[model samples]
Structure formats: structure tokens, C-alpha cells
Target: MKIAVIGTGGVGGYFGAKLAQAGNDVTFIARGQHLEAIRSNGLLVKSVNGDMHIPNAQVSDTITDITNADLVLTAVKAWQIKDIRNDIKQIIHEKSIVLPLQNGVMAADELAEVIPEKQVMGGLCRIFSLIEAPGVINHVGFKPEIVFGERNGVQTPEMEVLSQLFDNAGIACKASRDIEADVWKKFIFICTSALLAVTKTSYGELRELKETRQMMIALLNEIYAVSQKKGVKIKPDFIDKTIAVIDAVAYESTSSLTRDVWEGKPSEIDYQNGTVVKLAEKYGVDVPVNRFVYDCILPMELKARGKFNRQTS
Candidate 1:
């Protein structure tokens, strides 16, 4: 398979490496020091599952470097989806599949706004991984897996082929019956965890403290209510299920949004909890907890985006 990976972060680097390792034609699109490092020293993945390296990696800063790619993984931050839509479209042929391994629910729809809806698949990845350094990916926890499918719940031959290909590369992937609901299921955990940004608390401290834990539940319930109003087929006990997922993770863990906020980097705040608040309003559902979290993060988020003028204030 010919694969093009845009944004060579943890998700892209790791999965692209695996696909390349399995002898597929994989081109990684990256930039800056990361691109230089991958070009100079190849890509390295430090994984709990197992560490791997690919020397002489095929990497480029330009998307047009790859054309007619069989698959394109837009692994950039959720907010970056719209910005890269035209670039992604350049690399894919008509039959090429575009999978988004982002953290939020809007990736597919965002891509479909520009790219063909049939080419955009609803997808999400299950892995606690990040770029440790320029060209190094760190996989800390969870068995890495990808759940994706056609948004309309119809299976295609490409889906079957991709499933077998992932299996061949030793990647755990599933074709979902209801991709929207699956995306929302993952959203509950991530949206709740993103609150760590406002609280400046670790997963351990957030879930261990009785008061914070209750607040977390409130946030989860608000998201659940919003999801229900949106007609996402989430489970009734999803809050408990999400809590169980939180309990299983290492307490010291922090969400990507939290880490980005703490490091003063632009983040997916508008696409995660903020998205919840928007959807809630659109659906006439009250999501006070989500609204509070979104409001708390807005100042820093605006500053990161250079929309907040600190000196003038």
C-alpha cells in the first residue's frame, strides 16, 4: 500500500513506522527540526509494546511530494484539520482513503467539507503516545489500536483490505458499525481528561480527590447529556465506563490538551470541550460543566493563538 502521513507526531510516526516496517510505501510529511531529524537520523519509537527504528525514512515537508497515495492519515491536531484539507486532497487519488486519528469527533466532517465525503472515514486512535523529541515518538500506555469505518455504516471492499493490511502490520484495528457513536465514546474520556488543563492536576490527583472526582463526573454527565441530545448512540452507563478508563490509566498521565496548555502551545481546546459547549447550545442542552471548563481555558487558548494581547492588558 502507498501511504502518506501528514503530521509526523506520535500517532503518525508510530503507525507510519509500523506500516513502513511491514514493507509498504510510506511517505511522512513533516517540517522544521522534526523533519530534519527524521531525514538525518530516521524515526525512533519508544513503545511499551516494543521499541522500533526506521533508518533512512522517507520524509518531506511538502505534501505534494506524495501523489496518488492509497491512504492518507491526517494525524495533525484536531484544529489543524481544516487548514490542511487542500494539502490532503492533493495527495489522494479518487479511491484513496483519508483517515483522521485525531482526538475529537469533528475530524471527518471537517475533512468532508472540502474533500469528498466518501473519501473521509470516521476514525479515532486508542493510544497514549506523543512526540518525545523531534523525531522520537513515545508510547507510554494502552495497546495501540484504531477504530474506523464509513460514516454511513456501510462496509466497502477498501475497509476489508485495510483491515487485513493493518493486521499484517501487527496493528489492532476495527471497522465500526456506528463510527459516530464510537467517536463519541472516545470523546467522553478525552473531553473529561482535558479538564486537567484548567485544574492543573494530574490524572491521579484529579480522579483520586473526592471533590475533583465528583467534578469530573459532572463534566462527564454534561457531555453525556449533550451527546444524547445530539442523538449519538452512547451507552447509558458511559459515565461509569469512562471513569473506569480513567482509573486504569497511570495517575501521572495528562491529556494532550493539558500538556499543550501548560507548555503554552496552540491546542485543540476549541474542538474538544469547546465543541461540546457549541453542540450543547445548538441542541438546546445545558452543559454548564463543559461551559465552565471551556471558559477557563479560553484566555490561555486565545493567547496561544496570538488573539489575546497580553501587553495591552
Candidate 2:
């Protein structure tokens, strides 16, 4: 299948290379130093799975250069979806499928606001990867996996085909039975763990310390409550499940949000915990824990975006 990978960072770079390696027609969309590096050196993936090089990678700074694509994997930051929706429209035809492998629940909704709702698929990815250099993707941890399906959880022949395509690329992937629940299930952990960005705690320290663990549970409960109010079907013991997942991770592990905040880079604060706070207010649900996390991070987020006036302080 012909594939267009938008935002060729870790998620897009790693997966797109796999697809391209498997002989799929893959066009990578990138800009700046990354684009130049790929053009000069192709895309190099240093992975725990196995390192691979795509010399002569088909790439473009412009999205429309692809002309057409069978699938568009949107791996941009959750906050960036809106900025590229119009560009995305330029490459897709009626049969195109758009899958968003962002960290939050709002990606599909954000894309669907401009693209056709029928073409957008809710999805999430499990991988610890980053741009180690301009053209180098570092897959440092986690066996990569992708779960996606139609927003309504209904299966389609197209879903099956996509699953097979992933399998052929040696990627571990599955079509979700309930994409909504799956996305929230991942969210419950990610949004809660984002607090570590503020506390500067590692996974080991987070679960070992009494105060931090309690705070983690409180944050998890608040997000779960918001999900319930929104009618996403998460199990009652999901908090325990989320905690177990956290405990099993490597001791020093941290979330993308945590790393972004610590590095003074723009983050998905608005889409993750911030989204919960907004939804809680909308649905009349109490999310004080989530509110606290979001509030604490807001200033750093604003400062990173050049929206905070530190001189005024």
C-alpha cells in the first residue's frame, strides 16, 4: 500500500521505515534539518528490535508531494493536528484512511473536524522512541505496537487489510474491538504519569514513595471519572491495572510529556490532563486532582510556547 507518514519523528520514522523496508511505497513528510538529513543520508532507525537504514528515502517537506496515498499515519504531536489538517486534505482522496497515533483521545476528533469523519480512525501506539538526531530515529525501549479501528468500534475489511499490512512489515499490530476504550485505557496511564514531569519522579520512585503513589492514584481516578462521565467503558479495576502497568516498566522510565517539560520543549499538556480538566468542568465532574496537575504544568507549558510573560513576574 502507498503510505504517507506525516511528522516523521520517532513514531512516524520507525513505523514508516518498517513499512518502507517491507517494500511498501512510503513517502515521509518532514522539514528543517530532519528533511535535509533524510535527503542526504536517508532515514536511519537505531532500534532495540533491529537497526535498519532506508537510504534514498522518498521524502518531501511538502505534504502534497505524495500526490496520493492509501493510508496517512499522522504521528504529529496532539497539539499539531489542527495545524496540518488543511495540508492533509491535499493528499487524500475518497478512499484514503487517516490514523492518528497521538497520545491523547482528541486526535481523531481534531482531524475529523476538518477531514471527513468516515476517513479518520482512532489509534494509539506503544513505543519509546525519539529523534536522536536530525535523521536518526532512536527506538530505545518497548516492542512497538499499534492498535486502531473505526471510531465506533465496528470492524471493516479495510481494517483487516491494514492489520495484514502491519504484520507483513513485521510490526505487532491489532484492530481494536473498542478503540474508544483502548485509547482511554492508555490515556489513564499516560495522563497520570505526566504528573511525574512536575514532581520529577521516575517510575520506580513514583510507585515506591507513598505520597507520589497516592497522588498517582488520585490523578488516575480523576481521569477515570471523567472517562466514565463521558461514557467510555473502562473497567472499575482499571486503576489497579494502570498501576500494575506502571510498576512493570523499567525503574527510570518516564513519559514523553515528562521529558518534554523537563527539556523546556512544547508538550501535550492541553490534550492530556488539560483535556480532562476541561471535560470534567463541562460534564460537572469533580477532577481536582487532574486540575492540580494541569495547573502546575500550565506555566511551564506557556513559557515553552512563548506565551508566558516571565518578565512580568
Candidate 3:
């Protein structure tokens, strides 16, 4: 398979390396020192499953340089999808599939609005990994699975072929019959955990405090209510299921959003919890918990991006 991995961050770097090691023609689209390091030293993945090194990595910062891709795995931050939509269009043919493996629920829809709907697939990934350095990705935890499918829950030949390709590469993957539900399931957990982590700054601390734990549950319930109002078929017990998943995570595990905020980098707060709040309003479902979390984090997020300015009169 010919694959183009846009945004060689943690998700892209790890999965792209696996596909490349399995003999797929994988092109990593990245920039700056990361791109230079991959070009010179190779792309490295330090994984709990096993470490992988692709020394002869095919990498480029320019999307136009990659003209032939069977599959395009867009792993950029949620806020970056719209910016790269046109750039991605230049590399894909009509038969190419674009799977967005970001943390938000609206990525596939956003991409579809910009690109061809027939080419966009709703997708999400389960992995706790990050770019530890320029050329290295650290897959610290989680089972690391990728779930994707056609937008409307219909199976297609392209989905079958893509599933087989992932299996061949020894990747834990699922072709979901209902990809939207899968995406929302992940969204519920991520938004709740991310907001709690943002406010508390530690997953351990967030989960330990009874008051915070209750707040986390309330946040999850709010997201569930909003998703239900939007007509997404989340399981009735999804809130309990998500809470259990959160409880099982490693004590010190923090979300990428929290890490980004703490490290003074731009994050996807507006796309995650903020999205829930927006949808809640649109659906007439009150999501005070999500709204409060989004409000608390907005100032910090703006500051991280240098958009916050204090006014003194």
C-alpha cells in the first residue's frame, strides 16, 4: 500500500513507521527539525509492543511532493485539519482513502466539507504516544488500536482492503460498522478526561479527589446528554463504561491536551470540550459542566497561543 502520513506527530509517526516496516511505501509529511531528523537519522518508535526504527524513511514537508497515495492518514491536531485540507487534495487520487486519526469527533466531517466526501472516512485511534523528540515517538501506554469505516456505516471494498493492510502490518485495527458511534465513544472519554486533566493538571490527582471524580462524572454525563440529543447512538451505559475506562488508565496518564497546555503549546481544547458545548447549545441540551470546563480552559489556551491580552482601564 502507498500511504502518506500527514503530520508526523505521535500518532502518525508510530503508525507510519509500522506500515513502513511492513514494506508499505509510506511517505511522512512533516516540517522543521523533525523532518530533518527523520531524513537524516530515521523515524524511531519506542513502543510497549516493541520498538521500531525506519532508517530509510521517505519524508517531505511539502504535500505536493507526494503525488500517489493509496491512503492518507491525517494525524494533525484537530485545529489544523481545515488549514491542510487543500494541501491534502493535491496528493490524493479519486480512489485514495483519507482517514483522520485525530482526537475530535468532527474531523471527518470537517475534511469532507473541504475534500471529497467519498474519499473521507470517519476514523479514530486509541494510543497514548507523543513525539518525545524530533525523530522519536514514545508510545507509552494503551493497546494502540485504530478504528475506521465509511461515514454512513456501510461497508465498502476500500474499507476491507484497508483493514487487511493494517492486519498485515500487525496493527490493532477495526473496521467499524458504525464509525460515528465509535468516534463519539472515544470522544466522551477524551473530553471528560482532558477537561479534568486541564483543570487538575494530573490524572492521578483528578481521579483521587472525590469532588473531582464527581465532577468528571458530571462532565461525562453532560457529553452523553448532548450526544444523545444530537441523535448519535451511544450505548445507554456509555457513561459508566467510559468512567471505568478512565479508572483503569495508569495513574499518571494525562491527555495530549493537558500535556500541550502544560508544555505551553497550542491544544485542541476548542475542538474537544468546546465542541461539546457548542453542540449542546445547538441541540438545546444544557451542558453546564462542559461549558464551565471550556470556559476555564479558554484563557489558558489563548495564552498558550499568545492570543490572550489583559485590558486595564
Q: Return the TM-score for each candidate structure.
A: 0.98, 0.97, 0.97
Candidate 1: tens digits of C-alpha lDDT, residues 1-313: 9999998998999999999999999999888999999999999999998998999889999888888999999899999888899988888889999999998899999899999999999999998889999999999988999998999999998789889989999999999989999999998889965689888999999999898888899999998999998898987988888899898889899988899999989999888999999999899988888898999889988988999965763
lDDT of 2 by residue, 109-223 (tens): 9899999999999999999898999999999888899999999788998799889999999999989989999999988888965688888998888889999899899999988
Residue 283 shift from truth in candidate 2, angstroms: 1.6
Off by over 4 Å in 2: 310-313
Better of 1 and 2 by lDDT: 2
lDDT of 2 at 172: 97
Q: Please list the residue runs of candidate 1 whose C-alpha ends up more than 4 Å from where it truly belongs after superposition.
A: 309-313
User: How far off is model 1, as Cα RMSD?
Assistant: 1.2
Q: Rate the local accuracy (lDDT) of all candidates.
A: 0.90, 0.92, 0.89
In model 1, state the lDDT of residue 37. 95
Q: Rank the candidates by lDDT, best first.
A: 2, 1, 3
> For residue 148, what is the lDDT in candidate 3?
93
What is the C-alpha lDDT profile of model 3 across 1-313, one tens digit per residue?
8999999998999999989999999999999999999999999999999999999999999888998788999999999999988988888989999999988898999999978999999999999999999999999999989999999889999999988999999999999999989999999888865565456646667878898888899998988898888889887988888878888888888878887777778889989998998898899988888888888888888998889998999
The C-alpha local distance difference test score for the whole of candidate 3 amounts to 0.89
Query: For model 2, what is the alpha-carbon lDDT of residue 153?
Result: 80
Q: Among all windows of ten consecutive residues in candidate 2, which has the lowest summed lDDT?
A: 304-313
Q: Is candidate 1 or candidate 2 better by TM-score?
A: 1
Most accurate candidate by lDDT: 2
Candidate 3 has its poorest 10 consecutive residues by lDDT at 193-202
